[model samples]
Target: MPSTVPDSLDGWWCDSSTEYAFVGFSYEVTACQSRSTLNSEFKDIRETFDGRYVRLYGACDRTGFYDDVIDAAWNNGLGVHALIWFGFEGGSEWKDRRDNLIDTLWNNPKAKFVTRAVQFGSEPLYDYVLDPSDLAGNIWEFKWNIEDLGIPVTISELAYGYQVRGGAQIVLDSIDVLDAHILPYFSQTASTGDAAWKDVNNDLNWFIDHAAGRKIWFSQNGWPSTHYSGVEPNSPDAVADVDNEERYYKLLESKCEFFKSVAGGGVGWFWHIYADWQEPGYGLYAESGKTKFDFKPRTEC
Candidate 1:
């Protein structure tokens, strides 16, 4: 693999082609998805959404990992934000998983070429798999292991994760970019109803202020399209319906430029999931491969 990336994320992620401000989505790949399916999916994202990147999970699929994901992304001209998902399992196995992926990357030259960045683990700190200091160590280890790769390194975390225990300065100080998964649905502000868009901006401003001068990029942010009911544990206003989802996207339209501006925040953002069939809910594309709403530059992700 070449040690240098030709079009590295040197400044900030940008895409003048899209009518939408968001540049990417969090797509989880699976073994059942064929090469053509992967190709079609990546092609659809680029052509349909004018999307420039995707934050990928499930690289370590239980059946077996797919190298085709990177190939499809490169073929579609979209950067891949690769990840080592440390899902809630608080065990020493996380380190082994990290090392295994590093070894895999060393063998897969295509991965190094198309990688936008190497995310050590998504929400490890948030999941309590590792505390701030331990997570920071893992980040540094991954950074050091891939030093020759010339890629930026980071970990995905909720905004409040950094503030845990009066701020996880060790972990916060480790990343090249502050990769966050800020969603209003999980916050108290979701009870505010029709003003969900305002909540998103307020949450955004909170990140901008607390970014510690590092570049900030939202790795995941989207409302669930599924409506709620009394049976659901969440309050009546907490669950998002189709109407609320549409409102959130539409209201966010005016602020797209600001969100993409380096002076405004630092980096671009990504919608949570790509398809409902793959992960269920939170998808721009429904189970039938149809769009769930009238969102532009993306009727479906």
Candidate 2:
């Protein structure tokens, strides 16, 4: 793993659902829209938000949906954190899908320039889909296969999983980068705004202590702008509207700057998404493709 870390946090998690109406089995979420609509959304993300990189989940299927996503991102001048989806129940099928996706990316010329890294999977351990040892073994195998490409490989996990679960250390040691999802809304104790920052700070510190000097990346982080009925019942107020979303983003920027100063720039943060989908309130842009708020990062306190 390289000791150097990216100096700025300017990435987003993008998906093909907005256009393709694909079923995201892992989360049971679906986005039903047109390809043109999705393209326009990507354009808005690039031009309006100033996003430099995008993280995508899952491998390119036979339909080549993700290939189109990679194309759109590169054409819009965005790098990619390409992720491979792993479903624990179907080991053989999952391996085949993973291989095909990798082959598609490796063979594509655009991918050569836009791929920032290849993530093995997202939140497999946290979801209990794969035990840490099994996940670590799979990551190691994938890492070996992709090492020739000279791109870093990692697995994204919930920040506290490493400390709460027994086997995350092996998984952590296997990857080139440490990707953790830090969502204060999901904490056992409810929190919002500046109070949420404390939770995030504690999580970040936990990662720093266990990461063994590896670069730490926040694979997903964001506050939803609207409250969803029945979802997050325990932390209902954790969801924000336009105004509070701005507050959270600013707080996030400040925290990132602090982390950069302490970690010496070996950290990066990717907002949860570019636009809202089935999950409302997380998108920087609304479903109608309007900017939700001004989201400038604070370089200094």
Q: TM per model? A: 0.84, 0.79
**Model 2, CA-based lDDT:** 0.63
How many pairs collide in each candidate, listed in order?
0, 3
Query: How far off is residue 23 in model 2, in Å?
Result: 27
Candidate that would win on lDDT: 1
Model 1: per-residue Cα lDDT over 1-301, one tens digit each: 2334444434434432232357777897644577788899999888888788888865454423536777787788888888887665455655666777677667666666677787777776666677677778878878888888777798887776666535677876788876777677766647533466666776667667767666667787777767544323244567566666666666556566565564433456787789877666678888888988866643222
Candidate 2 residue-wise lDDT, 148-258, digit = tens: 666778887787666667747888888887777877776666456556877787888888887776767777776767777665635645645777667777777655436
How many angstroms is residue 39 displaced in model 1 relative to the true structure, after the best TM-score fit? 1.2
Which candidate number maximizes TM-score?
Answer: 1
